[model samples]
Target: MAITQPEEDIEPTGTKTKWQRFKSKYFRMKMLIWWTLLGVALGIILGAALYSVHPSSVVITLIGYPGELLIRALQELVLPLMVFALMSGVFNLRHSGSGTGRIIRWSLLYYLLSMILAVILGIALVFIIRPGRSRPFAANNFANCNSNVTATGATRADKSAVDSLLNIGRDIIPTNIVAAAAAPNFLGVITFAIVFAAGLITFGQRAEPLIQILEMCNEVFMKIIYAVIACTPIGVASLLASTILKSCSIISLLKALALYVATVLGGFLIHSFVLLPLTLIVLSQNNPIKVIRSFLPAIFVGVGTSSSAATMPVTMKCGEDYGCVPSIVRFVVPMGTNVNRDGAALYEAVSVIFIVQAHGLTLSVGNVIVVALTATLAAIGSASIPNSALVSMITVLQALSLQEYIPDVAVLYSVDWLLGMIRTATNIWGDACACVVVDTWARRHAKKNGTLPIKNPEPPAEQEMAMGVDSSKKDEVI
Candidate 1:
């Protein structure tokens, strides 16, 4: 008697081949994190080797061109990505109605609270470490600072706290949408997206077609972002290499900034590892370590790119992979990029105080209060781009009537590349934590009220192909 073939043996050859192809693609995607790590290591090694030989400007530029291209490509994607992501998220939340407002309020409260804690931690650390005491900076460093200032025709005027508040107000309500987008006034862009989405929801069924379009656009942009992210390892390697070559001559400056660096880094470590994680655990009851492990891909990209705005796409993807609902990921992450800048606030607070101590000036109680307030406000208003903190730090100094010490800001800028990377990583980490908190809260609130739709189960295989690499899936995928 003839026996029927086994089910596995009888599977369609074409279907079997498709599955094999998917598995291969999945393997490559899963290895991206490891490839990124290798890129960082190679970048350090190559950069260090070239720095010893004193690479010329042309060489540095040539090595860094690909990185510059990567930045431009990511920036090109940011405005559209932010708009679509925010609008889609809001439209989806329209089903929950009042729940939308609650999420927004919760997001803002978390942003404000986290940043305040970070600033407080930074201020305390700087006072304890006293990095600026004894004016550790060398004479040549001052000369370099002064000459750079003069050469650039730099001028500073004291700005009142009220002016800073007014500037933020103006940015929040841009007269021209095109100008706001071009100015890359992200806060304005964010304000517009939220309002536009609200208007769409107001029109109800009339806006259904538009909402579908937005969801489709978001999917398309996300695909484009993944294509760009595929190039991250190469881009990161070039960026790090160029940065190393540029900083080769700053060996002495690094030594002088040792204590200053320690204080800043110490504050960041506490904020990132201790305070933020505890917030996640206590508030969400989710394992912080597991969440952080899920966030590793975004963290590495943020560190390499050094711009939270640039890293937004990756952050959103990671959030989704970690099982956060897309609505929360899209809304909270974009807002957090602009508002929840714990690292920037912390860095600015430490910086102004360190400068005061370095210049041998005592801060009155009023001045210290001003520093804390201005640093917090400035960070809230700062752009999510590289080196933007430097501009906001000026506001802090001017508010405290420390314009003379403004020139010393140049010394800090010299080492900002390294610090910028570390702080950017911290900022991205904080954003992920905020997502966890908001998503958990929203799920619970929805459950109690029975108003909001529950999140779906993990996406299907096609969607799973785009998911962030998780620590748990390392064996199966990697």
Candidate 2:
């Protein structure tokens, strides 16, 4: 016989070496992280050097254009992703062992509990830290920025807390679904999705083909987001740099706002890294670190993007990949992106407290409690978009009739983009945790009802040990 090599002996055609594969697959992503860090470093350095430059200068504007485009792209993806992803979620719940109604109940319960806890934590932290009020430099140094911010907020803040709360509910019930869809009101769009999904589930088996179409649409949107996300390093660098260039003076900005920044970020770190992870441990009865590791990809993406609406696809994928039930993954994640805003709730409460304190006012125990409650409600009404918290912070400020204090919101606004990323990442993590909780409940519920279809892995090995199969027999079978 000819000396011919076996197929296994031959190297696979078109297969790249390990180094080349790593270069192709991970080079851009690794670069993205390093560049973002570099951007922040460079931003602060260049900002200090260029403090004399005006924000509207051609160079700053051009550098900012990429970041602006990224925001616009996120806006474009928001509506369709919410509608179709939620539709897919409902579709899966209806088909999976856990039916749609049960998943909805699980989703809402987790969402509400998360929001309430987050709001309370946020208010309590700000109260204890006393960031803005303790700092004298910030109030005295940024007179122009503060004045401009005050003028913008005063006009819209005439309503009381009660009035704002009442109006917040009304915004959820949009006048026309079409207008909501086009204007891309996340709350309205989410409501429309639920009703439409309920109608489809009413069709039962007939909805299968339509659900497949939606599944495909969801995948397409996810791919698009991934592609757009690759551009984030440049976009983030541009955005942060632009923010720096717009500053009146770096030393003044830092001295004035350092305490407020620390308070907000410290609270987020405590909540996200400590309290929230501990809650996950209690709920899932699993290693919280392992659970968090499963979702790191999505978390990083959310941090980069700073919008839950934009981060939905990655959030959904993370849940599924973590082995959550399909129904829970679909329903819980989409709904969570819209409603499970633990971090946003926390941020808004802190922002309100920081602003109130910075303006040389104080809230009593009763008023502090009320602000916490109002902040939780406002977060529910707010879109899962960047700077929407600023929009709703007006309601909280107006309710207190400290509309004059609104100007200091500008200090908070100075670092909103970077702060938005941290909070948004925390928000996505909450949503992922909710998925795990819902999945755990659904699995238990299904098992109780004897409908759970548990997939058996390493069944052969397990049975081998249990049945005492001989090694020879095992080898023969193999």
Q: Per-residue lDDT tens digits of candidate 2, residues 271-326? A: 88887777778876757788889999889877776677656666767877888855
**For every model shown, what is its TM-score relative to the native structure?**
0.55, 0.57
Q: What is the C-alpha lDDT of each candidate?
A: 0.69, 0.62
What's the TM for model 1?
0.55
Instruction: Point to the candidate with the largest TM-score.
Output: 2
Candidate 1: tens digits of C-alpha lDDT, residues 1-478: 9999763344443444334543544354345445555556666677778877776678888887776776667557756765776676556545543325677778878888889999999999998988866543322222243222221112222344466456665766899989877765655666788799888888878887888888789778867766776676676678767765655244533454788999999999999999999899788999999999999998997877677766666788889899987766766786787677999999999999887765445665545666787687667655565555755676666555455455455456445767888888999999999999988998898789876543322222332232321222211210
**True-structure lDDT of candidate 2:** 0.62
